[model samples]
Target: MESSTEAYVYYDPTKQNAWVDAILNGLGPNKQRYYKVASLQLVTLLVIVIAKTEYFSAISEVETTSCAVGLMNMIGNKGGCAVRLRLYDSYLCFVVSHLAAFTNNCERRNQDFREIAKRVLFKHQSDPSLAYLSHAWNGGGDEGVAYLAHHGTVLDSSKQASVFHADHLIWLGDLNYRINLSEAEVKQRLAVNNYEELLDYDQLMIERRAGRTFPMFEEGPVEFAPTYKFDAGTDRYDTSAKRRAPSWTDRILWKKPILGREGLTQLNYNNCMAMMLSDHKPVQSVFRAQIRELNRQKQSATRRALQQQLTETPEEMAKGTISSSFIEFDDVQFLEYKEKTLVLENTGQVVAPFYFLAKLDEAQAIPPWLQVSPQQGLLGPGEKILLQFEIMIDASVSAPFNQGQELSHILILRLENAKDFFISIRGNYQRTCFGVPLHLLSPMTIPSVNAEASLTSPPERRKHLLQSAKTTLANPSDPPGSVSPSSSSSSLSTSQQANLPKELWRLLTFLWNKNMLTLPNLFLEHGDRMICDYIRKCLDAGDTFDPSILLGEEEDQTQEAVGANSVIDVLVAFLECLPEPVIPTQFYAEALAASDAPDRIKLLKDKLPPLYRNVLLYITSFLADAIQYAPAAVKQDRRSCIVSLFTVLLRPDLAYKETNPALAQLKKEKLISHLLSIA
Candidate 1:
């Protein structure tokens, strides 16, 4: 009941418009930003967008006072989190909290701290160590929230034992109470309260009575000074005695001296950016300290889990694992493949520690190595050794060094020739997911690789572009059963040659000067079987002609191939043969769809019938797809192609049921079902 999702929650798409409006007005990164931009809608024009990202950790601020110890509640979370970062041999819960109210309900304050601990415990359900990271939140300044006000159970003396006993507790918040308060003054203050609330706010105490949290207190003057101030003159702060000095808010209480058992102890309130971010001047204390119990616990737990995953087989670690380290990387180093350098380390026992590497094509192992490392000494039970190496990498291996360009490869290396060494590196393979043979090091690699040109759209958009080209050539009727020649055939200008593919231009020159519609013979119409057969004859052994051959030739070549006076070639030329752009979008889609060399063959060869069928969907699918398949690349052109395609596909043109119908009607409920059936 304390925390529940409200109806019409943030993700409801039904209220999408309203949500966008609200977000544009105000927004937040909830749950530390795991749920980012789940919805992005353009609410208006002429607006600016700013982006902020939050990664692993977060900081919180709360009000408190009347507490002697500062607190920081280290709640463990599961985004690559852990416990056990050993600081100075002692282990303490990694928690931080502001001072609690020196008030009536000590039990309530204790419960809140417990709740924080529980939260950390729950966040890391799988961690084996004692759960959570907690620290005392303390304060000192009179300007900020007072520690003894409402929830200051942290001060309850009765609960001091358990609080002190907690194994890994760190205190780093404002506490109105001071460690060096005069004994008489401390005694006098306690007299005002009864039983000190048996609840003890007992999470832990500054010092004195303590049980387990921290086994033994680190001797004398360990806890001291007022973490806060009361300066009414500043208006930002108030000055008063009971109103201040005793504030122990910003203190870091550890089992023993943290940095070096013997080190200077001073508080610096300047490390934090105070004037702008917080109303109170933040406090920071540095003890040339070692790690804390909770710190070790968290760190150990996280590293262990990551190491565990690295050792798992792909089948075992199919899903992604935590990568605290990966987040810190600048850019991934993609190494070029080397034969001798590629060695896999074996981690399994009873197997002569196989040191074999894998290739891009092979899932398990390959003949050539992707990586190479000096042989690590044999690792047997209780056998420990570290590797030290220095090898001059030969430029010939990748050629990047030799050629001054880049070369990339996917190679897996196992530690000690282990099974799953370099498992984390697998993600880099997606960059080369498409099965293609890349130049080991192209001579022109550094010439700035560009993206593939956008596919020439189905002639529909610039129907006029082609029409204008067509007009340059004089028209000829079916020359009485053989393409009829136009009176101006002899006068055909150079412009007419510009429109046709090279091969078509040549063949057209030999054919009668007839228009494509009513070729010389009924069998010769552009789409008629005879014309195709004739073209097939020219392309194959006979005449060596086919539809694809025509499509493949360049415009200038086809134009010249289809010269004006031609009799036979004019009737069968490729440029003049394709169905008009008014044809169904699906028809163009098929050509675009099967345009890929392999897919088209598959379609032509019936390799994947559905893809061939799916081709019917796009007049021209996204140009991004084309760039990926091309021998030549064109980047920006592909983006423009995609933008134009989205606009055109949505336009009501020739009806193409196979592809667009599904897209237009694609709702969440029906998408998966339809995708399963088609391309």
Candidate 2:
């Protein structure tokens, strides 16, 4: 509705008053009793469908906006209205908007929608005390809530404004996107009940494909006929001289919030085809949106407690604590899943906003074996939330801890602008064959395959595999002599490799390679050299490697499973795949003896070939470098593994077993310390 007095403004409440009154009067007594006006702005209206008078009374926090973006700001009036109300425990947002109109102005219409979206803001209108309490509980007041909402929720506050900060967002209005067909062609399609065929040419669909409108919104199929360009009081299409093509102008779309009820399901979406008071028929959509129902009485009690806690002294506010200072998982069976809950309570006055932060210098914030939920949140005073801490040592999760070392970890939880709390979490992972050396996997002393082994051997193995398969099928329980040794060896290798999951296999291969040659060799051959360069570039620049690429397909799943991320996740997986340390399980005593041997340096040097020695030295050095990227509290375990490796190499079991005991003890401390320092 254009303003009669001012050409600059399209919203004139004075001019809309009479129309509003007429509409209200037209709604008969029965209809009037069922519906109440939630908002009315120039030419745009929002009405809540209520079953009873008490229903209308439950609604709260009404917000409205009218944006004039028409020519000279006089003809078009884009308006929006949003109401925030709690449907049980779920908060709902109902929005309505009117955008710019015209057949070929879809881009302009999109701009109008964006403007309305940015301008429409909903103010929380709950109890003043509760609102303040929630904000306070958010920890940093408004600032804290805003920050947490950005990091923990789907809504991005740093980007353009949006009304998606609700449990359910239902946007309804005249979207004004038209059909991309001529009037005659649109009618031809409509006459044959081929609405689905017409949808591809729908301007709204076209704009969506072009990424110009409704990025993440979902709307029901337009099974019903188009609602625009109809004659008043009739179902006939536009018969004007300037024939307007039929278009689904008025639309109802919605976005289900990420942090809310299950989701929204469409019950019915169709047009009020019979009513034609204007050129546009009305569109109505009924949705069965899931709402979480909470006990109001219990919530009120919690709020009261929160309020009481808020008024305590600053000293009390600084004193928050968890149910226990340490959580001991004892022993989690490898490749088995177990979960323990840690109850964190706000022991101090005021709200405590808490989030898990990885050690600043560590590549991964949390160990892969441990998974935590609700990475960040706020807790009211005396309020306790159960933090689920899980240990799942599958091939992927165990790859990093494969070395023969005890599984012990310390987790740090930080409170908003407060002291950090340490939670000692430790678990013993069951042993597996994944990370054990080839010789250690079975009693057989398998010869090492040289790096110089023919690269074409894989194809040869495949050829032999076919024959091996035929032999097995021909005689199900054949004797050992039935298959040739090479064929048997290939079959055995294939079977063992197949049993290991993809993640674990890669990890084990990386860890067992005494030298760090696998990476360079693989990349130098098959992988793109640019990727290698990129890694070098990132490292040289002191920039963190992009884990998104390393995790690849596992990125999303891993992030969903664990609260932490690391650039060396793949490397860590390799470590976890080890069933024993680089130095075998029964070699600890030998390692100690070697560390004490007189003339141990020469003895150790003579035991390993130059190639093997270099590889061993490389591995130890690489591990030592990797420790800097590990969490501060967990670095010691990594160092222990490295030291064990160094000990085994410096004091070879064969050489040290026969050493003079007195002489060994004499040089033990100094030589061992020197070796450890270097390692």
Candidate 3:
């Protein structure tokens, strides 16, 4: 190896000018040469690492320097110096330390080594784009280790990654660990050039075996003589009366690299015989470390892959195609469903990844009739994947579509850098509401009354509440249930009341409660049951309640109805009872279309019968008016409820289709848009 002196200047802190010559002298003839020199405690020890500017700039490096106290005052300053570097594809960390010295003090030397190990923390400067590669280590047995790094300003200096976080680690310095033998014994072995025998008494080796020092470090065989305790200016051993035993104190070691893929072969491990500086002979080792060379083609491919991942623009992701733009099912039997698969092909030059999102940012875009899997994923170029879609007709879901409604959904498929694609999903839903009314499912409704008067009249309803109150007051000890009936207030028998739809009594009770039902525990405890019953009742009614009840009547009427606490004249009242609207308020723009449409009745009737269309139109108009009075928060909640309810109610089975498929499709689209709006 060729050697060149960049600059030759010894540092002496005791002098007035520690940097004896011009600092610029450190710059060699090659202006591209860069170097960093660090000193410990007034230049007691120095660590310097150098590399060509181009090479340094081409790699990532993070360095940490710390100093500890070990030996006599001015001579004892120590600590390891470390640098974490990424050369090509491999990460490497190098550490150099000067530990406590002297004979028979291996334990103290081990302690010094530990101090350096603990305090020499590396400040990793990892690339943010490669963040996913942070968890790079996945090994087994004693080699098992994991390293996680991130790009951020480290706030806590005390917390940093250790030197072991790299794929390779090299630790070297004047460790100051002496031999565990007498001077005579060491000389006896050295006289015969028996360095191997002397190594048996090596303090570093003994300390390591006792688990008091470097644990998993590996070192090459030391065939040469010890490099410590030599007479100044001579190749002879210490000549003083207190002759120090020759020990292999100055050394180099490293933990084996991951997978042993890279070998650290010591080509030359020997002591220098020429230049003499102090009482210690300078030791040198020539190593031929095997490094995995980067393959240009592979590297280019990797860079492309990473760059693609980093720049996730929709334009790139939009380059894909679906086997079909729409998937339609003729029917989905209640309580039963079939699974269908749709293929997505990556037709672009680059890899494509996509995800399914809710419609218009609603919590749920897919109707109850549909269930999808693998919400999000990635695809390679020209690759195809089958997405699963199952149509499930749950009884709870069926209740909302009790009239056998059509199920239509415009599902959104979003690509990373591309415009979103809409997949039309059409299916017929079969309705079966638990095969019975809500009254038959519970025990409290057996004695309820039949409110025969125009269900839309408040005065008639008030009379019923008064009669019920009187009847209840007549028996003050009766326990009040959420839907307990006022048996004495009506002419119906227990069986007759039980036979009526449970939703009827529920609505009546809601009217009796001054149109205010505390529903905090409504659907939570008995999941889906309450929602199913409410939906079933709404579908069976074929009628819409009067909006005036919820929007508020005249002040005189409000006062008069105080004790009356009656009348849920409009189906909108059921919507009012909900905390969050079935259709989200954000979609109010779509819902408003229903009310503003000049031919809304005819349009609505195309999908629903005249009775149902009129009912829906009335409710739609009421929602538009309610928006004017409802608070912002209430509007948001109601919007979600409205969408959810209509999503269930507006099924294709309920639509009166014409012979023309295009017109049928147009009618369906109009109905969906109108219903989704806030009208």
Candidate 4:
């Protein structure tokens, strides 16, 4: 079979659109051998054309005219073009898109693809002059008859006009997916022809695996070298200051047709390395597609025969059963994993294909923390499958849980051609100090052990307690002795006027009193889990540490004591876990600048919040003492290690790390070291 070819060009208005005629004239000396089906230009960025050979035109017809959607001027940059062709009774859609560029804007590119897919509309062409005439004249006019013959009402509605409606879809163009590695790292790997390792870091592959972009699309193996980021007219990479990392920005990807249809097999996929007029190399792909042809009269007769047979002997309905309608997990802790299993069984004689459906207006079928494996599947009669539901809370999603939002959802279980079932999932998220704002945590009193038990109480009672606590914390001006409605019986009281949180002070004093800072690898290694949990419980309960409970008759009283490192670890974690660091991120620039000034301490103190100022001073003072008393053998390097450790704990926010991580980290270390010297 002869291969079908497609091309895309950037539109230049100044050239008087000569490329259109050039493309048509270049086809061949025999003009009647090919036909132009559609042509469209979007803004000044994209030009698309669809043409077919004389043999193909003789066999099939053009179903719809070309449609273009521009995402550049108003919403974003770049856009897409789409057209449909019909061969026998099957519909095939062809799409060419140019997505957003740059490595950091990968999410933007994904958004562009979704926007184009959702907004592009294919409509039949009708003369505007006929709409203003009489209805009777317009209804039976020659133009209306011509329009119906050439471009019939192919799509009933906007929803049905999407690319997914076609029997076979082919999507190709400059996708602009970049490599996730640094420029130097990409160059090092490419030098040795290490395409396999480089593909692991490809942004497109990573996003595809995470189901964030192009969820069901498939691409052939990219065995060729990087197809982007080269010096124009030369094979060497970009020598400019930008130093853009090489990427597979130009490529092709396709989604298979629906079930019961033949699939497409990729024949060839590679790049044109010799033609380097632009920074990006040109890529091409060929596929061997199997097309199914049908006779309309015969197809209609067969459908009627099948319907007559179905009426004579009715078919059984699909039915299924679930192990439970309600699933509850154990109490969830911050950064901890909790999971539950659900069993789905096909109880009926017929095959049952079930899927978890998302609620209306929601992007995902399940919440970010909760994951349902095998979201959709088919089950044979008497077949059962185990569905694992798991939940994990990390910093990105901890804000809502810490704000007293309940962890629960109602998932809709849908069976094809059957009724839908609702499954209720609920879990108790234990509140912690980790993700709570400093201002909010400062005004709230620690609940007693019995008050903590209220988290597991009935829904109404728990809601009342959480609402009262939130109300009390919202007013930072509340008096020190004010008590929340839920915890009025407890001895603990709010201290809105405290300079620093008592929890932080407790951890700091324990490390100082126990001399745990002198221990080797003091914050470098993790501590015992049991001891760390004990320290956390004590801090939250407003109770002092009990050496008898932690040490348990060991009586060593030396640096070798097992609890020493644990205490230090808990202290550092306390500071690191605070929603805002000891030195708030907003003041980072000022602090770095102040490090070189004569009155660095005074400059920083004036700029910092009272709570932050006090916390920074208290921790640095303790570190100064530890450095002074360090043993001679390790004293020289101890200060530097301490600086590095505190730099990480104090700043914590590294959102800008991708730009120049090493330089930013060095600046932070210098600032911390200067603070320690003065302390």
TM-score of 1: 0.21
Model 3 root mean square deviation, Cα atoms: 28.8
lDDT string for model 1 (570-674, tens) is 322221222222122333444343323333423432322222122222212212222233223333332222232222222223344455332332221122122
Residue ranges of candidate 3 with Cα displaced over 4 Å: 1-43, 69-76, 128-133, 137-159, 209-211, 291-679
Q: How many clashes (backbone N, Cα, C below 3 Å) per candidate?
A: 155, 17, 45, 0
Model 2 C-alpha lDDT per residue in residues 205-261, reported as the tens digit of each score: 888778677765778888999988987688999898877899999899987334323
Candidate 2 C-alpha RMSD relative to the actual structure = 26.1
lDDT of 4 by residue, 476-552 (tens): 34343432211111112234225446666565556564245555545433345578788877765667788876556
- Higher-lDDT candidate of 2 and 3: 2
Among all windows of 10 consecutive residues in model 2, the one with the lowest summed lDDT is 482-491
The number of the candidate with the highest lDDT is 4
- Model 3, span 415-478: residue lDDT tens: 6666678899887654332332222222222221222232213655535544653443244241
TM-scores of all candidate predictions against the true structure:
0.21, 0.40, 0.39, 0.46
Those runs of model 4 whose alpha carbons end farther than 4 Å from true positions after fitting are: 1-318, 347-354, 448-497, 514-526, 552-554, 557-561, 588-605, 650-657
Report the alpha-carbon TM-score of model 4 versus the true structure.
0.46
Clashes of 1: 155
Candidate 2 ranges beyond 4 A from true positions: 1-37, 43-51, 71-76, 85-90, 125-162, 209-211, 291-293, 300-679
C-alpha lDDT of candidate 2 relative to the true structure: 0.52
Candidate 4: RMSD to truth: 18.0
